[model samples]
Target: MVAYHSSALDGVAANPALPTPLLLRLIAFDGGGHGPPFQALHRPGLPEPAVAAVLTHPVLNARVQFAMSGQADAEQRARLANDSSPRVRAAVAYGPEWTHDHRTKVRPLPDAVCARLLEDPEPSVRSALLDSRHLAPSFLASLVRHPDPAARHAALRVWDELTPDGRTALLDDADPEVRRSAALCACPHDARLTAALLRDSAALPEALSHGLLRRADAERFLAEGVHLVELAGNPSLPADLVDRLAVHPDDSVRLAVSLRPELTEARRAAIDFTVAPHAQEHVGWVAAGIADQGVLRRAATSTHPLLRRAAARSPHLPPDLLRHLAADTDVVVRTNLAVHHPDTPEEVLMSVYARLGGTFSAWMATGHPHFPREGLAARFADHPDGIYRQLAVRDPAAGPDLIERLSHDPDVWTRQAATRDPRLPLPRLLEALALPELASSAGANPALPAGEMAVVMDEAGVPA
Candidate 1:
């Protein structure tokens, strides 16, 4: 068996591709209250056999059912919504965001189940329902005036899209805190109200960060000097104000200005902004969502390195533009292309990893689906940097002896990576599992024989 390096070495329970029969056995094992044993059931496209095991297993724990709640089919979801355990019910109400593998996006529960959850007898379940992103507009409207202030606050997630009547109700809410939140939520869409709220010193910072700011207001804040950072980040700041802030004395403010999407390459380069070694707050490209071809084309060709980097982050960039960014002069741009672009070429990902392999963010490039494995061992096994040597274990062509040698390497990460390699001998793999530091990754190595897995499960008090 070969290691699937595309997935992280999280643990056995998190491995989405575990065989269906094994998954069924895991479902039958009671996890007590611990999470891992049952978590695998959350994987997308969970087999019908595994789902049946979770639902029918006589000894299945409530936590087991809780973990599978989100990915449950429509009929199963309805059953879970009325589950005997409140915790299980709450799990369904929360609407888990992603399937266990992080591949499939989980959809909202059926409308009927959502309606029942809205009025669930347990306040915990009801509270969980409010946190769900899938709630309908009408449900949110009903929640905005809920007697519980927390419920009303939770409903404000949809405040920007709330109906006029809903907004009015929240504006006049009995709770002063609720009223304050309502004002902030309405500020972007209600220019007159934003203008009025600007006069209040307490509301000024958040207002400048996201609320619409007129030229006069920006100038006044500039003179005041306290909110310059927020002013630079404000999407609605006027063009002239944006230009003025680009040259502002504060480095943070200038950095923020440099990231504004409206600035041309020349304007951005003139700012003398410093790109921090690590990422700071997300820039305009992130907020703008998926950009159009025209926007991406301009960003890719921009003289400003950060603009090119921003374009690299666009997953939908055309093939030519993707290649352009892959070969970009800036390492950051190329790295971003490797990490974010779905179609980044194999060579680009390898190059980025070879350069940044020791860096914390390098995993993103190495773990990319397109990363090459054919010659990795031969290329990096003798490299001076242990980080590069660590990658040799990922090479499918590497032999058992090489895997064993690396498993004993002095570099902790190298040892860890080697331990996860399926090529490691059975005795060595079991030895790695005995070591607390390496056990998790060792268990995650899909190469472990099924008979051995059953024995391991039995030792954990989970008999097949």
Candidate 2:
């Protein structure tokens, strides 16, 4: 079988004039956005005929069209805007589901689709319409007044897009959440509104910070124990108020101070200093923050492996402790040192690997932070122990060539492991399945083509 496109939408280009059976297979393929195969497709270009086939695909599955809407020209987007499946229309309204911050274009939806999806029955789909550029000021004005307060909460996401009038409508909303969200966007609120919002327990910190409430009001709320943690987080607090909270009885509140110079000895010994139940990760952080050599050394030698693992990762862990931890009996502690302890000497890392020669940790320490080079990955790939070789095969640094070699590993179990690696793209997966011993496991691999998975059994002459 030909390899499926990484993104299901690209399958339309497989044959712009696909037969019904093939078209059905393409449409039935996973969305490839987040599920099995875990791949995303990118087309060199979309030919018009292929898109027409995607729209006309007899099956009602519209997810392919949904994925393609992002790349469609204005006219094609308009046609997709009217697609019968609400799912397709929702996609048109939503535009591209993913965009990085540096990307210049915040993909805008068509006005028609944007207006409709604002009231889309699907809550999540409706929330997405908040990002569409085509949702103009006029539409947002009406949306802000919609009876549903939920619409107001959703509107806050795109608050930067709203017109002055639209912004005003939300600022004056009866709903405290709308007002709270508006304040979150840094909109100034009047005293009357602030007073009302301050009384709302749910609206505590946001409303108080922007509310311009009197110091008396703030002190009253603080005395009442309203939003102590939140008050601690408010960056805009008056300096006098900040000094008062710095010594507040709550240790957690004291921890919240971003510029807190140091912890008092009594505070350091508090129960909050270390998390309980075998993950003293917090203790590691506190000790590192203080750069206390005594604390780190004690934690490193502690009988508890979790504390040792935590201490191993500390920047202040001295070279002597790093050496001590490299040879630790606990597998987690030893691996933690290999993967995370930068201060450990190269000689120490090498010795750790020699002790646990077959492990990923052993292979990993050769270059330290840099992935194992070809020579090291190959050494593990060619290791006598199938498990270590399997680990090497699974490592991202081990490229396709290593995978091809392991696919024919004499042990059926090793070949089976080779078949299911999520990184083993579909073409490599199919090639691995050619080894009949891999057949049973290949069918179970999430990477197998959903519609054509039967091919694994068919070619291997094994039953599903």
Candidate 3:
């Protein structure tokens, strides 16, 4: 599978007719006063012409230059390291595609470039560097004592890599926040430190809740009558204390107790818990450990709805389980299966889209590979709801006239979808490029010929 993040301009970039020279021109198109420069420069393995154009195109603006820096070669990065623009330099510091978590195996910057960025005058550049996984161990150790408390906390992402002295420094740091972060990093391994963190009022709630609290410490927290809400959710809390909190006077405490993973449905029913319909918190069982197929199957068939919801999030579920959950009575179960499960049936995705048409999850559902698009024009061309009408453009059955007419649809989503559909005639497509609202989708429509795209670039004032 091609491991690339989808971009709005991907169809334009992927056009076979878009020659090297024209793609290079995209690096300097200046967006025709519409939006950011064409994102083709951010794709991997740019031909030498595109690389040279980015390096030597003095007229290229800062934002386009920043896009090139994401995929720059070591030599290109070395040049960008000294570029006058802080944003460009910041991009160099962060390595390739740092903003997106797609690429994991990134080559580190040259040692000199790393040294320069560490002391770079711009805080944004240094901040971007902290987020990059390409930073060397030595740089990470130095950042542990950085003047900025946030940097000190961020550096703890690689706590095991830090020197023993560096770890001790964070644990004993004067800043309570830094110490609290260190406690989170160290508590799982060090019981003594975990016990100490449980005493500090500032750290008590998080430490008691997240750390594996000792049995005695769990009892102590219960006896104190403080942080009961936090204690109720702690996995390490003694069974007796968990029972005691299930009936605690505080509603929040019982609510937390009711959601604990160890509690069976019968036990949870005994608690006076009022579930907020929209915001019921389920255990993130997938994150906790979801590899065992047996455990996943049990979760899928569990009597508790939350367990079924968690099971639906497992991407590796067998087709039988997916079918079972897709037909599950719970809306969240069906939606989660559609959004997260790779083999979710086409019918389930359309159902979720119908229920959550304008939501983020609905966007994800429509983007799924198996989403139904082939005959949608016949089904939704004149649906009363504009969201349903937008599906018409996705259907091959949608005629050029239908697409052009929908391009003028009052609903923005329908209009945008029509603008991207290749069936929309070229003249109307070019006209859509002038509308700031639709330029991005129009610019990406694959039907726009390579010659016309070059003309669009030239009109946008690309350098010769």
Candidate 4:
């Protein structure tokens, strides 16, 4: 038999003596001669039997009852605060909720209440007291050395509000993580402490970009290959260093340097043929290119090779101007006009292609989104380059013969691209699934029979 508190039935002389088991059953027993115990306990102005049952035998939790009961007022809260169970005391401490009118007038907890909890034997109760935003700064400063690291960590959040004397105490403390946390929020600008903090790997990234490390230290880390990828990605990385890394052997390193916020980064990522565009030159070019009545006037008169190239690459430059640029004395300017200007008219491109047929510029123009697909079928249908045939297979104009021809193209790329063709029938799709290399791509084609797809995946041990 389970024992229950007799306090549940106090102050009821009229209540009949009931068996302990029967009363225990009544606690959870909502159905009774007095209807449900729940309705009787909570509903006001109840009949005597229901009230008697509720007052005598309650199965409902005390916290829920306390939370719901209006009678748990200031006096009741104080009474519960002294209860032997720490749980009851903690619940009581959550209370005496301030009224809207008194919220601004009230502190988070009364000084006396805070004082009591500050000394609570239970860590949970004491930890709850740490949530007070309005706690005295001196109090938090003192807790910084609290025996419990959890409490100390909580106190660290208010480190900024602590007296400078208090902050000085923890800044050089033995714990590195605590020191790192301080460095992040403080931005103390102390070169020595910053260097020490950076020694901790956890703090290295922030330290590298804190913009306080000497240029030598930053460059030293860069040279030693320490955190190169992350260091390259740092926005605060010196421009000179970024320029140096643009040609690094590692593709990811160069890619990182290329993604910087401005045109410097763009130019870094570009094929910097022989001579590269300078930052100032790019700025001047953008200015003149966006200016009205000036690109023609400027390019005709300007002497800077990079500036001339930048002007040639502008989309707003007229077809007549693009044609003129195509014949420029500077080969680089002509190349930029041919390959980089997306808005250059098609007539200009065809003319450029005819003159510069074998150059990289012409090859790039051939695939430009605006390049007319007028003869893509004849030009690329059986082109030696697999990429070209892959493009041909995907072209909407590809006829059945070309699609079938590409389905067996020596290049797997062309074969994969053919799987998307609506004209490729179910038999060809089944053949595609039989090839392990093409099975995944072929499985995605709706034309493949569902049963065949299942069989192929099962044989291949593939999940649906």
When 1 and 2 are scored with lDDT, the better candidate is 1
lDDT-wise, the better of 3 and 4 is: 3
Clashes found in each candidate (C-alpha, N, C closer than 3 A): 0, 1, 0, 0
Ranking by lDDT: 3, 1, 2, 4
Give the number of the best model, judged by lDDT. 3
- lDDT string, candidate 2, 139-174, tens digits: 555576777787676677667677788778888789
TM-score, cand. 1 = 0.76
Where's the lowest-lDDT run of ten residues in candidate 3? Answer: 1-10
Worst 10 residues of 1 by lDDT: 1-10
| TM-score, structure 4 vs. true | 0.33
lDDT of 3 by residue, 287-363 (tens): 45565687677677766666678888878788788888988978888888777777889989998999999997788
Badly placed stretches (over 4 Å) of model 2 are 1-48, 62-79, 91-112, 119-153, 160-164, 174-180, 183-193, 208-213, 259-376, 382-404, 408-431, 434-464
Better of 2 and 4 by TM-score: 2
Query: Judged by lDDT against the true structure, how good is candidate 1?
Result: 0.72
Give the whole-model CA lDDT for all candidates, comma-separated.
0.72, 0.55, 0.73, 0.53
Measured over all alpha carbons after superposition, the RMSD of each candidate to the real structure, in angstroms, is 5.6, 11.0, 6.1, 23.5
User: Which ranges in model 3 have alpha carbons more than 4 Å from their true place?
Assistant: 1-17, 29-46, 55-84, 94-123, 132-155, 158-180, 189-191, 214-216, 280-286, 290-299, 408-410, 427-440
Stretches of model 1 off by over 4 angstroms after superposition: 1-25, 31-45, 52-79, 95-104, 133-186, 200-202, 214-216, 233-247, 355-360, 399-447
The list of candidate 4 runs beyond 4 A from truth reads: 1-84, 87-115, 127-142, 145-149, 174-180, 183-188, 209-211, 224-239, 242-464
